[model samples]
Target: MTTTKERALDAAICLAGSQGIRAMTHARVDAAAGLPKGSTSNHFRTRDALLAGVIARIAEGERADLAPAARGPIHSIDEFVDVFTAVVTTLTGPHADRTRARYALFLELSSDPELQAPLRAQRAAFAELARILLAGLGAKHPDAAVEAFMAFGDGLILHRLTVDPGAPVRRSVAIAVRGCLEA
Candidate 1:
C-alpha cells in the first residue's frame, strides 16, 4: 500500500511537473494528495526535505521500473532494446508527468547543494547499470558507451518533454540502442 509520505511525494512531483516547482508548496501537496492541511509539512519539515523526498521517490520509481531488465544478464541487443523501449514508453507516456517533474527538480538541483549528492548517486547507479548492459553487448568501451547512451536518452527525454510531445521516443530509443549495440 502507498504510504502517506509516498502520496505526498507523488503529489509534489505531479504539482511540480504540471505547474512548475513554485507550485509544490506543502499546502498544495496536501491538497493535491487529498490530505488534511499541514499533512505534508508534518512529514517534510522543510522545502529541502520535501524536495529530497521527491528526488528519492523518483529514484525509487526508476529503479522499480527498471528492475525487470536488471534481474538478469542482458544477452542480446533485442533484450536491451526491449528494456530501453519500456523505459522510454513510460517516460513519454503514463509517467510523463513525473518525468517532467524530475527534469524540473534536476534544474533546481543545480542551485541546491544539499540535494546534489542523492541525485548524483542515482545518476551514477543508472550509468553503472547501462555499463553492465553495454558490456554484455560487447561494447568496446562500455563506460563511454554508457555515457553516450545516457546522453542520448536524456536529450530525447528533454525534447519529448519540451520541444515535441508527439516525438516517437520509443522508436527513437530502440533505434539508438540498436545503433549503439552495432557500433
Candidate 2:
C-alpha cells in the first residue's frame, strides 16, 4: 500500500493536472486521496513543501520510464531520435496529465528562485542524459546539441499537448535530432 504522503502527492499531481494548480489545496488533496482532513497538511506542512514533493514524485516516475533507454549507449542519430520520439509520445499520451502538471508548475513557480530549483534540476537531469547520448554519438558540439534538442523537445511536447495532439512526434524528433547532430 502507498503511504499517505505518496497518496497525497499523487492526488496533488492529479488535481494540479486536471484542475489548475491554484485549485490544489490541503483539504482538496486530502479529499482526492481519500484521506482525512489533516492528512495532507500533516505530511506537507506548506504549499511549497507539497509542490516540492509532487515534483519529486513526477521525477521518480519519469526516471523509471526512461531507465531502459538511459542504461545503454545510444549508437546512432536514428536510435536517439527513436528514444526521444518514444518520450514525446508517452509524455503527450498516457503521461499527459503529469506532463501538464509539470509544465503548469514551470510556468507558475518559475519566478521564485528558491522554489524553482527542483523544476530546473529535473530538466537538467534530462539534459544531462541527452548530453551523454550526444557525446556517445560523436556529436561535434554535444552541449549545443543537447540545448537545441531539449528546446525543440520542450516546444514539441507543449505543442502536441495543447495545440495538436496528432502532431508527428517522430518526424519532429528526427528533425531536431538531425539538426542537433549537424550543428
Candidate 3:
C-alpha cells in the first residue's frame, strides 16, 4: 500500500505536470490524492518542504528506473543506445507525467541550489556511470563524451515531450551514442 506521503507526492507530481507549479497546493494535492484536507500539509509542513518531498520522490523514481542500466554491462554502443532508448521511451510514455513534472520543477526551482541538491547528485551519479561506459566504448575523452551524451539526452527528451511525442527515440539515442563514441 502507498503511504499517505507517497500518495501525496504522486498527486503533487501529477498536479505539477498538468497544472504547473503554481497550482500544486497542499489542498489540491490532498484532493488529487483523495486524502483528507491537510493530509499533505501534515506531512510537508510548508511549500518548500512539499517541493523538497516532490523532488525527492521524482529522483527516487528515476534512480530506480536507471538502476538496471547502471548495473548491466554494455559491451557495445548498440547495447548502450538500446538501453537508453528504452529509458527515453518509458520517460515519454508511461512516466510522461512524472517526467514533465520533473522538468517543470527544474524550471521553477532552477535558481534554488538547496532545492536542486538531490537532482544534482542524481545527475552526478548518472554522469559517472556514462563516463565509465564511454571509456569502455573507447571514447577518446570520457568526460566530454559524458557531457555530450547528457546534453543530447536532455534536449531529445525536451523535444519529444513538447514537440513530438512519437518522435523516434532510438534514432536520437543512436546519435547521442555515436557522438559520445567519437568525442
Model 2 TM-score? 0.93
* Cα lDDT of model 1 by residue, 17-80, tens digit: 8899899999999999999999999999999899989989988888888787789898888778
Evaluate all candidate structures by whole-model CA lDDT and list the values in order: 0.85, 0.88, 0.89
- Please give the distance, in angstroms, between residue 134's alpha carbon in candidate 2 and its true position after superposition: 1.5
Better of 2 and 3 by lDDT: 3
lDDT of 1 at 180: 67
Task: List runs of model 2 lying over 4 Å from the truth.
Answer: none
Over 1-100, each residue of candidate 3 has an lDDT whose tens digit, in order, gives 9999999999999999878998799999999999999999999999999999999998999888787689867898888888889888888888888899
Q: How many collisions per candidate?
A: 0, 0, 0
Model 2 lDDT per residue over 56-126, tens place: 99889888768766889988888888887888899888888889999998899978877778778878989
Worst lDDT 10-window in candidate 2? 110-119
Best by lDDT: 3
Q: Would you give me the overall lDDT of model 3?
A: 0.89
Worst 10 residues of 3 by lDDT: 64-73
TM-score of each: 0.92, 0.93, 0.96
Root-mean-square deviation (CA) per prediction: 1.6, 1.4, 1.1
